[model samples]
Target: MIRLSQDNAKSLLAIHGWSGALLGLLLYAVILTGVIAVFADEIGGWSSPLQHEPATALPKGLGAKLAELSTQVDEQYHDDLFFFPQAGGRIRTFFHKDIVVDGQPSAEGVEFDLDPNTLAVLDRREGISETIQQRNTAGALSAFLVDLHVRLHVPNPWGLLLTGALGLAMMVAAVSGLIVHRHLLRELFTIRCRRQDLLAKRDAHVIAGTWNLPFAFILAFTGSFFSFASTVGIPVVAMVAFGGDQERLIETLVGVSPAEDKTPKPLADLDAMLADAHARVGVEPSFVSIAHYGRADARVNVFTPPSEGHVSSNNLVYDGATGAFMHQKPGLGLVPSAGGVLFDLMGPLHFGNFAGVLSKAIWFALGFAACYVTLTGMLLWATRRAESQAWQRLARATIWVGYGLPLSLAASPIGFFIGRSLGIVELHDSMAIAFLSAAALAGALALSLRDLESLRRVLLAATGAVLLSLPLLRLATGGPGWASAFASGLQAVFSLDLAMLVGGALCVFAARRPNARLAAAARSGIEDNQSQPA
Candidate 1:
C-alpha cells in the first residue's frame, strides 16, 4: 500500500512538473517577443542609419513630392488620379490604383525616395543605398515584425488559432502554477536565490509568477479571446445563439450591411466628409473609411484619437452622398458596450502604440522581466533533467534555438545592408529564410555536443561577439555611426544597440557561472529525498 501510494504521488508530481515546464517555454517565447516588438518602431529606427532624421531637418517638400507622384501617375496610369499623403517619419510608397494620364493607365510608375530639400529622388542605386522613407511613425519593418510576433508570420486565421492555443496553454500553466504554490501571494516580493537550487527554483517561480499574475492573466486571456473566437467562440455562439448559422451570428454580433437598391450617384468630397466627421467626433481625424462611394447609400466613417479617461469612442459615420451624419456606432460613450470596449482597448494595451515613449519603456521593462521568467523556468527544468542524456540534449537544443533566434533576427539588418550593396532587391524574405536556416543549424550543432555547459558557453560567446560588433559594422558600411544616431535624435537606435550589448554580456555571465555546475547534483539529491524509504 505504501509503495503504491508513493508511486502514484511521484507520477502525479512528475506529470505536473513536465506540463508546467513545457508550456512555460512557449509562453515565455510569446511574451518575450511581444515585449520587444512593442517598441518595434524604435528598433527599426535603430536598424537604419538613414532613419535618424533630426526634427530640425526640413519636412520633405509636399508640393514637389505630390507633383512628382502626379507625374509618376501620368507616366504609369492615365486613370483619374488621387494623391494620398503619407504620415511623417520614415518614407515608403503605397501605390494607389486607378489613375489616368492619357485616359489609360500607364505601366511605368516609380516611387522615388526624394531628397527633402530638392524633392528629387535620392537615386543612389549603388553600394549601401537608401530607400525613400515613409511618413508614418511605425515603418514597414516594425509593422511586419509586430505581425510576425502575433501571427508567427502566418495568414490571419491560422496564426490566430495557433497563438490562441498557446495562450490557452499559458493560462493553464499560470493557474496550475498558482495552485501549486499556495504561498505565492505571501512571497510575492521575495527573490530567494540564496537557497539551494530546488528551493531557489521554487522561490523564483513563486515570486515572479505571483507578482506578474495579473499581467500574465491579461496577456493570456486577451490573446485567447481572438483565438477562442475563431476556434471555440464561433462554434458555441453560432450553435446556441444563432441555430448554427455563422453568417447570421456574425451579423448579430457586428451588424449586417443593408441591401443596395438605388442607382449610383456622384460621390461627395472626402475632405468635406472628414470635416463633417470631425465636427461629430470633437477631435481631429486619424482614420477615414468610405463604403460605396458613388452610390446614394454610400457611407463614410472617420475615427479620431482617443482622449484621456475616454475609452476611444471616436468614430463618426456619414452618408457619402449627402455628407450627413448617421447614427453613431454603439459603445462610444463613457459606459460603453463590453465587447466594443474590450476590442477598442486591445490595441493600446497590447502594443503600447497609443502611449508615447515613456509608457513604451515601461512596457519594454515588463517584457524583459517576462523573458527573465521564461529563461529561469527553462533553466530550472534543465536542472531537474540534467541526469537524462536525451533530455539534456533536448533542453540544450531548446536554449540554442531560443537564444539563436533573436541573435539571427538582429543579423537581418546586416543582411539588408549586404543585399542593398549587392543590388539584390526583395532581400527581406530571402534573408529571413537564410537566417532561420542558419539558426536551425546552430541549434543542431549545439544539440550534437556532448557537454551541455560547453555548448551553452559557445552559443553565449558567439551571441555576445556578434551583438557587440553590430554598431561598428553599421558604421563601417554607409550606415550611420553611434554619434550620428545620437545627432539625428534617434535615441531608440542607441538604446537598442546598447541593450543588445548588455544582454549579450549578461548571457556570457550566465553561461560562465561556476555555481551552475552543481545543479544536477542538487536535483539528484531532491529526487533521492522524495524516493527514499521513510
Candidate 2:
C-alpha cells in the first residue's frame, strides 16, 4: 500500500477529485464511445449488410476491376492505391496521391465502394481524404461512433491534441487514485451498503476504480501514444531529423526509398499476392496498399489484424510487378526495433482486437467500469460541495450528461436507419442531428424536472425505449429477421439485436428503481433549483 503523510494525502485527494470532475466529463465521453466502439465492426456489419454473404474479403477479379476503376481517376492518383473490406463485407478502395494539407501529410483522391459479391460500384466520392471518409455509408454508424470516440467529431491535429491531453489527465487520475485510495486491494472488496448514502457511493466508486486501474493505465498510455504519434510526436521528430519535411521522414521510417522507378510495368496479379499473404499469415489481411502502382518499383503491403495468440498485427510485403512474396515487414524501419514493436503493440493494447471477440468483450467491460468510476467520482465531488448553489449546478449538469448521453446515443441509429430507408446519401449528418436533438431534449427535461433522480429515471426510460425500438427499425429498413440472419451467416445482426433488447430491458429495470445516489445536500436543493431554472 502507498503511504503518504496526512497533509500529502489530503492534497492529492483534492487534486484527484477536482481534476477528475473537470476532466472526467470529457474523459467519460471518450471512454463510453470507446466501450461501444469495441464492437464497431459488429455494429457496422449489423448496420449495412450486403445482399449476399461473400466467401472472402479480397474478392476475385478485383485486380481487373481496380484496373478499370483506375482509368476513371486521374493519373496522379495512380501513385498510391489501397483497398480494404468494410465491416459489411463491402470492398472500399482508395486511389489517391499523397499531398500535404495544413502542413501535414494528407490524401487527395477518389474512393469507390464496391459490392463484395458482384463487384458493382455502390458509391463514389472525390475529395480530400477526411471529407470522403466522412461521406462513407457502408460503415457509417460505426465510423461515426469511432470518430466520436477518437476525436469527438473534431478535426485533426487539434482533435488529436485534445484527446491526447485527456489521456495524460486519465493517467494522472489513475495514479492519484491508486495513491489516495491507500488500501486499493482491501477496498476492492469492502463496499459497505449499510453506510451513509455518500459513503456507500464512494465505496462503490473506489472499488470499481481499483478493479479498473491496470486496464485504465494501459488504455490511457496507448491512447496518448496513438493520439500524439501522428500529430505532435511525428511532427517534432520530423522537424528535428529531416528539417520539417514530414513526407521525407515518413518515407525514411518506412524502410527503404528505392530509386524512382517510374518505368512502366503492368502490375502483377494482386489477387495471387493477397492469397499468398492469407496463406502465409493464416489471417485475412485487413488492408492492402500498393505503392507506386503500375511501376517497376511498386511494392504491395498487406496488413493483417493480430492473428491468434498475438498482440500486434503483421505486415507482409510483395513485389507489385512479379507478385512474388518479399518479406514480412515490420511497422517502422527495416530491422526489428523498439519503436515498431511499441507502435504495433499500442494499437491492439488500446483497442483490444488482439483475440477477436473475447478480447473486445473484456475491453468493453473494463471500459464500462472505468466510465462508472468517472461518473461516480464526479458525483462524489459535487455531492461533497452540494451546499453551494454553484456545486448544485455542476451536480445537475453531471446528471444531465451522465444519464442523457446514452439516450442520445440510442437515438442515433434511429436516424441512421431512417436515412438509409429514405435513400439519403451522406448519413452521418442526419445521425449527428438526431444525436444532438436527443441531447437537447434531455437537457430541457433535466432543467424542467423537479428532482435529480426523476431526471435520471426519465432519461433512462427514454434510452430504453429507443434501444428497444432499434431492432424493429432495422427490420422496417429491409434488414433480415433474426432467424433469416442466422441462417444466412449474418450472426452479427442477430447478436446485436439481442444485445439491444437485453440492454433496453436492463435500462428500464434500473430506471424503475433509480438507485443512483444524488447526495443528501443536492437532493435537498433540487426542489429550489428546479424553480430557479438552472
Q: Quick one: best TM-score, which candidate?
A: 2
lDDT of 2 by residue, 1-534 (tens): 788998989888877887787887898889999999999988999998876677788888999999899889998999999999886888989999999888777899999999888899999999999789778877899998998899998888788888999999999999988899887679889977885556677788888889899999999999998899888988899999999998788888886566788998888998888788888878988899989888999999999987766777889999898999988988777778898888788888998988889989999999999999888888778767667888778878888999899998899898899998888778988899999999999999989996888898899999999999999999998998887887778878888999999999999998899564563535644343333211
As for candidate 2, its clashing pairs are none
lDDT of 2 at 441: 96
Against the reference, the lDDT scores of all candidates come to 0.58, 0.86
Q: In model 1, where do residues sit more than 4 Å from their true spots?
A: 1-16, 48-140, 154-157, 190-194, 230-240, 243-286, 293-298, 311-313, 318-336, 385-387, 481-491, 501-534
Report residue 112 deviation for candidate 1 (angstroms). 10
**What TM-score, over all chains together, does every model reach?**
0.73, 0.94
lDDT of 1 by residue, 1-534 (tens): 122354565554455466646665566667766886877767666655354353422233533354446444432331222222221233333323333444433322334344333444543121111122211222434544566568776665678787888787766666656665544546776655675556666566568766776667667777788666766788798999889998887776656665663555655655666666556655555544555444576666666666545645476767767777776675332234776787777656666655568777877786666666666666666656666766565566566756666666555556655655566555555446645765776677675866555666666666676677766665665666677677866676678778877977876676677546334434463474453311
